[model samples]
Each structure stands twice: as C-alpha cells, then as structure tokens.
Target: MAPKFGTSGLRGLVTELTADLITDYTRAFLEACPTGGTVHVGWDLRPSSPAISEMVIAAIRAAGIAAVREGALPTPALALSAMEAGHAAIMVTGSHIPADRNGLKFYVPGGEITKEDEREILMRLGQDWEIALRPGALTEGTQSAENYIARYVSGFGTDALAGMRIGIYEHSSVARDILIATVQQLGAQPVPLARSDTFIPVDTEAVDPATRTRLATWCAEHALDALISTDGDADRPMVTDGTGQIVPGDVLGALTAQALGAQILCTPISSNTMIDAMPEFARIERTKIGSPFVIAAMESALLADPQAKVVGFEPNGGFLLGFTAQGPAGPIAPLATRDCLLPILAPLTAAARAGISLSELVERLPARFTAADRLAEIPTDRSAALIEALASDPAQCAGFFDTLGKAEEMDRTDGLRLRFASGEIVHLRPSGNAPECRCYAEADSPERARALVEIHLGKLRDRLG
Candidate 1:
C-alpha cells in the first residue's frame, strides 16, 4: 500500500514505505515545490527513520540539490532552521504513532506543507516520474538541536526557573536531550529519568494510566515543581502539576495565552470548552482538528488585526506562537510551527510570576475539565462511517450513552461532538494520525469527564470490534 498524507504529513506502516517509494516521495515534494539549493532533512528516534532519511537525502541529491542532514531532531527544530534559511526541509517521524509506522513532514520556508500541498506532491509523483533509488553519504549537522535550545535560552535567559525542580521523562523522544538541556539553561534543576532507545508512543492528548501514576509519583519523590515531556518528535508537550498529574494540553494553551497576554487564539474544536467560554481572549477562532487548520485560522485572525499577538495549540499540547511576546529574557520572534518548549515554559513562567504552583495556576481556570482516550486498531474508514451515522442521527450512538442523557445538541465541526441533556459532553472522531477512534469529553468535575471518556471509548471498542 502507498503511504498517504495525514493531518501533518505523509504516514503509513513502515513495511509500506519501500526504498523506491521513499526516494520518489521525496522527489515529488521537491519537484512539486522548488526551493533553495539546500534542503534540510531530519528524523525522529524511530528505527525506520534513519533508513528513510538516507532514502530522502538520496532523492534530494538525485535532484541535483544539496542535502544537509541533521541526524535526528524534533520536527519544530528542523522546521524553524529551515524557515530561517528560507529553504525547504523534511522530517521523518511517526510522531506519536507506534514504531511500526513512520511519516515525512515537508516544510516550505513558511511552515508545514498544507493539505493542498500534499495533493500537488502526490500528483507530481503519480505522473510516472522516474527515480533511481540508492543511498548516499552526507555530513550530519547539529544546527537543528543547537538552534532549538538557543531559541529558548536566548528568549527566557538563564534564571527565571532558578527555584524550580523539573523531572524530564526522556522516553525515546527525539528532543529528549535537548529538552533537558533547555531546562537546565533556564537555571532549573532537572532530574532526567527513563531515557529509552525503543520508540514509545506517548500521546499527550490521551495520556496512558501508567504515565499518569508515574508523573505524580515523581513529583512526590523528588519534590518536583513539574515533570516535562513531549511526543516522539517533540512538537506536542506533556507538562505536569506539582502534584504529578499532567495538565490537559488545551488548558496549557489557555494558561500560556493568559500569561503572554495574547490577543488572539486559534484552537481546534476538540480543545477544552473553557477556551471558548473564557473572557481573556479578544478574538478566538475554532477550526477542524490538526495544526494546518489551527495555523490557517491563526493566519486569518492575524490578517484582521496585524498587531495582535497570536498563538495556536491543539488538545495534544503543541503550541504555535505567531508573534513576539514579552518573553522572559528578550523579544522571542515568531515560531509559527508546532512547539513543545513554549507550552512548558510559558505556564511555568506565569505561575512563577503569579506566586503559584502549576496545579494552582490551572485550577484558577473556569471550572471546566476535559479527558480523552481512544479505541485502538480501528480502521479509519470504519470510524468515519460510524461518525457520519452518529453525528447525523444521535440515535445511532444514543444506546451507548443511555445512562447519561439524550443528545441535546450536535456539533460536526471536525468530528461528532454531542452535548448531553445532563450537561456532559462527548466528541468522537477518527485519529488524524493513526488507525484509532478518539473520544474526548468535558464535564464539571474531572472524575466525570474522565469517566465519560472511558465509558464511551469502551463502548466504541465493543461496537467496532
């Protein structure tokens, strides 16, 4: 099977990405959107990424373009450097997906390649374009990691986090070492733990129970101010409370916006509802799930108010800052791509400035709680059919939620989000990155929100199975 485009880029099973396919896909991306003489290529910690990187570099060189390889780094790091150079870049990562899968994210100096851009790449590749597939040697550079760490250090300075203690969960994340280094440069004492080589698919959105227990335990054991982590590619963040529980990503976004005194915010509909109900934002826009949609929405908002400070985030805790904010050390320039560092630092800085703890800072928000989980191995098409049926007619999903209440209102913005008569809510959608059905719910109490997600996800598994 041919690899297909996902919300961020192209992805599929590792077995599906043959050497020839990788070369051709890379060629298609370059041929579709010509760029500078040099193309920056990076990869994640996945075992498949290295091989794919060589194939991509070979393709880049085959096109008579210079290929600058940066062994393995976070997607944001590579993208930011590429943006600065005004050259195109590509990242080989499966993101949070299982190690058996992998993908390539292409960036055109401006940022991530859009849905339409993928279409053009696919069209060019489908034109019977000939490709000679072979591996090639290239000097690996350290610019991606160096610049990424510098971005935080240069903007935040050396001691805003002086008194805080952080536990960095280095779970095979591409940015593991860099995250720890960045934390230390801020003068925070960082406890590095559980660094692994095997890929671990840590979904910051639908956090697993083991991770939940471990973070809280780490805080108590080490007296940590928080535990910081990220997805495989380090775009999505996973930040915790002083008590060890991770704060939801959307909540992190709101906290960041409030701390930065941001004027405009763009988020996916699946984000915490409190974001929509919050009074802090002057302009707020909601789009379908994915970074492309959020970035596009941020663009429209920026156009309407050029001077407005803008930021975008997803439920998975990926933060995208559109303009310079009053960063701790100096003026932080715009990094209009998914970032993990900003989300972690912004909220911590806000809490520090306000004389509060991480949990306390989030607890001050508008009393709304959100929880999400997923049904694994469900076909995307099957999930789509189920979503279409349930969204159009609540009766299709009513039996599963019988204990709660009737579907009072339905929102099909990006998925099937059903508001219950009892004031609880559930949003069901196919995972944009993998073969899974995702469910997110919100309620007045944290327990109820999580329970709703658990029950709904359980029901989905049974039905889909």
Candidate 2:
C-alpha cells in the first residue's frame, strides 16, 4: 500500500488496495483485538468496497470472531455500531479521495489505531503472508442502518424540523439515505438534488464555486432552506444556506455546539477566526488539525468532567455530539469519529429553535473569508524545505505585507501558519494523507484572502520548482 497510514488509515488506488492486503490487514487487526469481541465490517458506495468488505468479513470470521456486517453505511455509523456492540470496526472507504482510490479505516474498542499500532499490524502481517487457507461465511445480518438513522432523528425531536426544507446533494455519499431519512422523520421536506450513481468526489475544503452557484439557483427555484452533502463515507459534512453560500465547516461546528448548550468544545486550528467569538458558551479547547487528535482530546474532556459535553471535528465543517450525557438512547455516547448527519440535523434544530433560516444563522456570526487550495505531487522534503526557508528568514519573505499597525506571529502547530498584522493569515501545510501541499488563507475580505493565498503560492511554487 502507498503510505497506508496517513492522518487516518491505509488508503491507496483501488488497484493497489488488493484483496489479499485487506484480508491480511483484517486478520492482523482481529488478532490485535481484545479476545472474544465482535468485529463490525462496513463499506461505502465505491464499486470495489463491497468486495473489500467481503474479504474483511471472511478474514474476521476465519479468525474465529463474530462478524456484524453493516453494509453500505457511513463510516461513523459502522464505528458507532462497533462501539455499541462493544467491539471494533473496519470501514472500507476512500473517504473524499478520487474514485480511483479506496482503502480501510480501522477503529478499535478505544479509538483508531495510531501510527505505531499500524506499524505493528503491518509487521505482523508481513511475517505471516503465506497463511491464507480457510474461507468463512458471508452471512447477512439484521439491518441496523435504520437504528443508526434513528439516533439523529430521535435526538432532534420532530417539532424542531417540522417546517424546514433541506436540499440534499446526494453525490455518492453513503450517508444520503440517513440524511434524507432523518429529515423526513423529523417532518422536514427533503429535496435530494444531484443524486449520482457514479462517484462525485467532493473536496470539502475546496468546494468549487460553480457547484455553489448551481446550488443557489436550485434553492431560489425550489425555495429550499439549506443544502447539505456528505463526503464519500458520510463522516465529513458540506452545508450551504438559503443564499447558496457554502458555510465554512468551523462555523457550522460551532453552531452545533451552541445548539446543544455544550460545556466543552474541541476542534482543530484550521477553523474560522470566529471560533473565539463564542465566549458565553462553555470552555473551548483546540487540538491538532485532524479527527483523531480531536477525538483523543474529546476523550480526555469527557473523562475529566463527566458532565462535559464534547462536539466532534469538522475537516471542512465540524460535527456535533448527539448524545454526550447518559440519555434514554443508552448514554448517548461520544463517537470518536465524524458523522456528517450531525451537522445537518443540529443546525436545522438550531435554526428551527431560533425561527430563522440557515443563511440568517451564518450571517449573525462574524464575517471572515476562508479559502483553501492544494498543490498536488509535492514532495514532503520540499514542503519542509519551504517551511524551513520561510521560518529561517521571515523578513526576506516577499509578497506578504504588514497592516493594522500590529506585528505578525508565525505558528507551527500542525503546519506553518503566518498571522499577519491585519488579522489576515496564510497557512502552508503538507497533507499527511496525500502527496500535496495545501494552502489556506482567511481574511476580512474575499479578494484579500484570495490575493494573499495567490501571492504566497506563487513564491512557494518557484521555490519548489
């Protein structure tokens, strides 16, 4: 596999993600599992995922473990099911990667496997590559997909979404069904737009402007309240309000926490400049820019204060915790994974409670223009060199200006972030999961943000070239 363990798990082109590799990885994971624990296997809508799911089931069964197959569900659904069953999960999904690639994300009883854990699994599998003999049953299990959908629907009582209209862009996401079902169950009119049989890869951070214009046109015609879409696996969310403007993930994440009256909020630093705007809400903590990091902090937040309510991460936008405290839904537990359904439902609930449209809720927040772009095929060493070059000589960095009569500060939390004097910031971070260097910038004006990003990228490209 090509760099199996990135920020999440093993992912590669479908051809490179062979059946043998999956079987072996599943076997290795099962071996590492706590004894006698059930293994939940699930997959997304990619054409090759079902076959990979089957391979995992065979491997898990061969290891003498019970297999609860959650066919064609979101990655978070599978994880939640596994956690509910008090077992582990293996999700076969490429997430937001192009249709050409596919992979597996494994979650254990505690959380996702760390880089060290993956290395051990890979080493163990390498030692026993030739031990492929027994085949196991692929028996179908009871449909637990409904129960998964019900969690979101039931959490937000029907009265909250009784009169809203949500437009779902069902572009090859496993959460399409749950998104529609939850809206319907909550008495909202769900209009599914752009339902595709073939995969439509949506880069959450890089939502195209053409798509946004198209959605706006549809909302105007249909008078829809909001537009929502999930990543390939339904773990990440993309939401747009009535104006057809795609709301930044961090803004939606914060609103979700606000709706729940959460005491504690955990998120990454790639969020909007407005996250610090919520001073009235409970404590807010920041983690490294990844779901696993957010999840790890969430675990500690919950542990330290039993009453602490934790919301999940938003790669593009954040996810809300449906059940933080012990509720009738059997202690609505904190999921260590992202669920797109929460962003859609929680904001709708909040909007309903406020008697306003999604656009209004977003308008009430501070104004900031956030944009992200990526330069593919960038080498890791080159990216490091660029950061090092900038850090070593900040005064020599051209095209970056000082404004607002203040000084600039540079932060290297997960990546290199330069905060300008004008509150405008630029970020250059190598994607841990891909061979690309992503550039993000946020400013008071859209043109300013775009211009700042372009200037920095132009300089970096020349250096890398």
Candidate 3:
C-alpha cells in the first residue's frame, strides 16, 4: 500500500512514496482541500525531493489545474508565498526524516490541514473516483525562490549584521541557500563549513553533542558572532552563540517573546518553563505538542484580543513574528505558520537594539534545558488499548499521577498530559505522525526529567503488555 496520511501528511520510505502514489494523493487532496482553487508546489533539498516534486507538479497539471513551482524554499516560505498568491500549496519535505524517507505537507486556501481534512484525503484516495477536467490546462507558473529570499532579506530591515562573519554548517539540508541569502542580505559575510555528499539529517528533538562541540569550536576560531542552520526543510532553526554553543529552541522562543514583546505567547507544553516565567504578565497559551495544535491556539488568542501581540510554537527554535491578536489577516496572518527566518533575524535585531552580543541576549532569558525522548514504533493497537484501559480505570491513572506529584491537572487536547508539581511535566501520547509512543519532559535538570519520563513509559509499556 502507498503511504497513508499521518497527523501532518503522508510520509513513508522514498521507495514507497513514488510518483504514482504522489499523483493519487495529489488528485485526492486537490479534490478535497476545502478551497479547490489553483494549486502550487514547493520542494526541499533531499536528493529525491526534487524528483518527487516534479512528479507532484506533473500530477497537478495532469488534473487540469494550474501549478506554480517554488523550488527549494523552506516549507514555511512556500506556504507564505502560496498564501500571498492566494492559492493552496503543497510542500514536499520529510523535514528531518532520514534521507531514505520523505513526506508532503499541504495547506488549503485558508490554512494548514486539520486532522479531519487529512482523513478526507485518505478517504478520497480509497474511492476509485476520478477528477473531472477543469476548464483550463495546467500552467507551470514562474518560480518564486528569489522572491522569497528577497522578502526575508527585506523583512529584517537592516544591515545590522553588516561585515559580521557567520558560519552555516551546511549539513546537506535545504536550508543552506536561505542561510547564505539571509546573511548576505544583512550585509554580513557567510562562511560555509562542512559540506557532505551524503544527507546529514539533524534531529531537532535530540541534537548531537559532537555537532554542538564542532559548532562552538568553529565560531571561536573564526571569531564569528553566531552560527545559524536549520532542519532538513528549514522550517525549524538551530542556532549557536559567539561561543559556538548550540542554543536550544525553547531558549530562542523566550528571546523572541522578549524581542516581540509578545504579551500573549502560545507554545506546546513541551516548551521550556521559562516561557511561562518570561513575560510574567503576558498570557501564555500551552497546547498539546504539535505545530497544528499551536497554530490553533495562536488563532484563538488573536480572536480574543485584536491588539494582542502573539507568537506560536515548538522549541525546535522556529519563531513566527507579527501575529496580532486579531484573526488571520491580523498583521502577520499572511505569513502564518512557523518560519526559520524569524529566529535568525530576531536575535540579530535584538542584539543590535540592546547593544549586546547574541550570547548575552540569550543569557538574559531564564536558564533552562529541555530534554525529549521517544519510545518508538510501539504497536498502534497496543498504544490505543493502553490509553483506553488507563482512562477506564481512573483510580489507577490517578495513582500513577500521584507518583509523578499529585496531578494538579490532566490535559487530553492531543494526548494525555499529566502535570505535576516541581515544575516538571510528562506528555505521553502516540505520535500523530508516526507509530511511536512519544514522551516530552522539561525540568530544572535534564537527568531528572529523563528519569521521570522513564518511570512513566515503563509503567505504560508494562500495563500495555
């Protein structure tokens, strides 16, 4: 069988997500995506992503709809371009997945795909139905790659980083171009370090210590102010300070909140507690751990206060700016979803504004380290049964919660999240995009948080068995 739609989109081994499968998904998605207007296609740097993107574009064309190609832009860049062009867009990226695998993220005219919408696309694929020819033939619209670069460059509004040296660890990801472009736009010099032929996938959830050390050393030797890079598709950011230490995403989020003076901050519960600590008066909205869930909360916050300054999710270090308290059109709606460029530019701007180093600005934020671990590929059926059984026996669940520190609260927006005292929390849920039972914990110490995770996961696994 071809890949089925997960929480985000359809992802599978490259061998499985073939041209034919892309065609089927595209046809079904185009037919079902609430706003059936013109469609656009964008892709990442994976060796196969280009071929798959071409196949996707061809399929869109074959369906008698116009298709615009935005080659090699970050996933969010493509989404923004599509939103601005007033068309639905599909981003071809496995985003931090291994080179052997790939996936697709699609957006409708209004916004990102909801769970129900994805299920509908799968349902359409199951049916042996064909789409009727639209009145027009497919047009390969002009590429907007340069335009996106220019937009990001201009958005920064300064040569604040002029003549500063920046090193981009081009670890075989799609972000290399924008990293260089953004640096150049700020009138700074960009040095490319360590280019590899084989794909070097970096997991945002678990960064390598070796990579961290390498970045730190590079910055010191070159006297560079910062190191900027991104995940496979560049939707998320990974940054380093002048000392070359890799800055975690949660740390970046806090700085962004400070920079934007975002009175209303929205982030996943997996985010650092510092998020809640910073902006003491600002209302922090914590949702289940996913960009979609974060986006939903972002929209709600805007609805409540039109003048409310807002930003949204994931400590993978992506910062989205300009979301006003108002609805979609509220100041930053046209540029909705997480973008890698914001984190890079915001820190630079904040440093310039404060006359301090990037490292110093980061230090100003409350100090915290967040660690996440996942028990991968648990049987889907077993996971469901475990959760159901736990829910059925409230007393047992409560007892477990007591061990964690009496559950002041339980949240099931996306999955079961048990919040404890001591500022420690455990999020136990099946991956919306994978077969894993995932756990995210944040505390004063990485060891304690991870230990808490082990205790919960072991119990769950044992009970399931």
Measured by lDDT, the strongest candidate is: 1
Expressed as tens digits, the lDDT of each residue in 418-448 for candidate 1 is 8888778899999877888999999999999
- Candidate with best TM-score: 1
Could you estimate the TM-score for every candidate? 0.96, 0.90, 0.85
Where does the lowest 10-residue lDDT sum fall in candidate 3?
A: 325-334
**Model 1 stretches astray by more than 4 angstroms:** 128-139
The digit string of per-residue lDDT tens for model 3 on 1-465 reads 236577567887899987778888988888888535677788877888889998888777767777877777777777777777778888888787677788899888766776668778888884554555663245554546566666655555547577578889888767787788778877788988887777777766656667878988899888898888888888888888888876778777777666655777788776787776665536888877777677777778778776667787577776655453221111223356667877776777678667788888877777666666555657666676666655567787777666665666677765676666776777777766665676667677657866776787677666654
Cα lDDT tens digits for candidate 2, 28-137: 77665552367778898989889888888877877666787778988878777777767788899888778778888888875566555666676677545444354433
**lDDT against the true structure, each candidate:** 0.85, 0.74, 0.72
How does model 1 fare in lDDT? 0.85
Global fold similarity of model 1 (TM-score): 0.96
Which sequence of candidate numbers ranks them by TM-score, best first? 1, 2, 3
- Report clash pairs, candidate 1: 216-244
Residue runs of model 2 more than 4 Å from their true location after superposition: 33-36, 114-116, 119-125, 129-138, 318-332, 399-407, 454-465
Better of 1 and 3 by lDDT: 1
